[model samples]
Target: MCRQIHPNLAKDSVGLGGRSKETINRKWDELAICLNTHESGATKNGQCWRRVSLCYILLFILLSSLIDNFYNCAESYFSL
Candidate 1:
């Protein structure tokens, strides 16, 4: 970000004038290109895939149990 911006500052400070809007825009595009070039592509947590899948499975089990308990209570109320 700084490398892209510094050229414009030098232009204005030395009477050369800041980058033209077009030049600034091109610099911004290049900056984005450079920034994205280094991406590792994986942005998730460090957990292994199997552990993550197991966590989701356990969560589903707990949620199903809650739903079953709720329906059981409703059924008992309707029976009464």
Candidate 2:
């Protein structure tokens, strides 16, 4: 679902952004139709996609594999 909307980011395309809003809207509409056709049970309303941004949230994470040992470093670095 997401990959369809942001194909360049998902696949690492290096293109600059100048595409019109209508193009993005059409992509969302097409994706909604495709998902509906597959019986995936996701929302068929393309507008629903605008309400959530899983990709943007994922971009905020930087800890990854270092989280388990985070406290070990923090113990000596902080007064907590």
Candidate 3:
């Protein structure tokens, strides 16, 4: 949580030699905490969305290919 990490980060930022490392570590920790706390359902939702979008893209491509094939077939039939 932000509440837990903020105080430590504030303290670390005031220190000199290892401040950069502490800040980076704190940021990574914050990211881990946030992801652990918040992304449980959201991660599933995101994957689901990606799958659905991929399906839609595949369907669109299939439909377009079918339409193109049909158009070519019709053109050849008319020419013959």
Give all candidate RMSDs, comma-separated.
16.7, 5.9, 13.6
lDDT of 2 by residue, 1-73 (tens): 5345466423333343565555666666766666667655666465565444444546545565467469778
Q: Cα lDDT of all candidates, in order?
A: 0.55, 0.56, 0.59
Location of the lowest summed lDDT over 10 successive residues in candidate 3: 41-50
RMSD of 2: 5.9
Over the stretch 1-80, how does candidate 1's per-residue lDDT look in tens digits?
A: 52544455224232334646555445545544544466675333322332454578789999999999999999999999
Q: Could you tell which candidate, 2 or 3, scores higher by lDDT?
A: 3
Q: Please list the residue runs of candidate 3 whose C-alpha ends up more than 4 Å from where it truly belongs after superposition.
A: 1-44
Candidate 3's residue-wise lDDT over 30-76, tens digit each? 54555447645443332344355468878999999999999999999
Per-residue error for 41 in candidate 1, Å, reads 7.7
**RMSD to native, candidate 3:** 13.6
How many clashing pairs per prediction, in order? 0, 0, 0
Candidate 2 regions exceeding 4 Å error are 1-6, 9-19, 53-80
- Per-residue error for 37 in candidate 2, Å, reads 1.4
Task: Tell me which of candidates 1 and 3 scores higher on lDDT.
Answer: 3
TM-score of 3: 0.46
State model 1's lDDT: 0.55
Query: Candidate 3: lDDT of 28?
Result: 52
Model 2: worst 10 consecutive residues (lDDT sum)? 8-17
